[model samples]
Target: MKKFTVLVLVVIMTLGVAGSAFAVETLDTNDMQQREERQSKASNRFEAMKEFNDEHDQIRVLRIERNHLQIERMEKAGVIYDLLIIAWDNNETEKLRAAREIRKENIEINREIRALHEQVRTARKEFKENVKAGDFATAQIHVDEVIKLLGEINRHNNIKVTNLDEIISVLQ
Candidate 1:
């Protein structure tokens, strides 16, 4: 009985050790390296966003941080997603230079959006003042300018959206 029990224990131990060794052999270092690279890239993106001359810069940074946290919570694998990332890492970079170009475009549009917002805001204030002062003709002109400025804002927003879509295509 003792001999049989010892043989059974040795067989179990040997099988467990062999199985674990196989698992270790199959594991790769790419996952850790990819995670670190992604962290650094996100930090770079956040810094670039903070350079914007707008009140929304903080909000942009916070949104990035929030998303980063969310991504961290998810399973970030390497080889499984490598087929897609490998292609993206190579060829798709030229389209938008790996998000850098698109990011620049978005920054420029954000500046334009800010300028348009200021114009529309002051125009609205002056429009109300003119109305109160019984300057109907001037108030009507301000209204027209406000409409034109708002249209410009919308156009810039569309450009930003397109830029974002381009980034998403290359990333995913």
Candidate 2:
């Protein structure tokens, strides 16, 4: 009976030691899991930040391209105006021919201008639609396009335009 009791006690002691060792390992495992969770969350945040940065860069590139196009349009407008002046300086008949050419060119330019205005109007309409849909990013993109078109129009005319009605009446 004495020997049996000592063997039982030894078994119990071994089991307790094993259990304590397992507990330590379990604690380490839990710590590792918590660290993994934190790392995953940080990775997700970094990915989101990268996506935002990429989108911002794309928008900046688009703005730069739009500005370059506006500058090109302004340069073309200046050339056309210079040609008109040169025609006038040559002679009256040449001036008349130049005026006719100017009128033709102006008509073409006016069409383009009106088309740009229509584009702006359409962009505004789209922006309103996007706003209603809660798509602020798309709305902002449309607004930027409208601003780009407006800049091009302003550079083409270089004149103060207060009232659309008066401008149309005068042009007519």
RMSD of 2: 15.4
User: Candidate 1, residues 116-162: lDDT per residue as tens digits?
Assistant: 88998998799767665556568667766776776666667656656
Q: What TM-score would each prediction reach against the true structure?
A: 0.45, 0.39
Residue-wise lDDT of candidate 2 within 83-155, one digit each (tens)?
Answer: 5555557644644554454456556667787888899789879966765555667866877787788767665
Could you tell me the lDDT of residue 134 within candidate 2? 53
Best by TM-score: 1
Native-referenced Cα lDDT, model 1: 0.64
Off by over 4 Å in 2: 1-91, 159-172
Worst 10 residues of 2 by lDDT: 159-168
Name the regions of candidate 1 deviating beyond 4 angstroms: 1-97
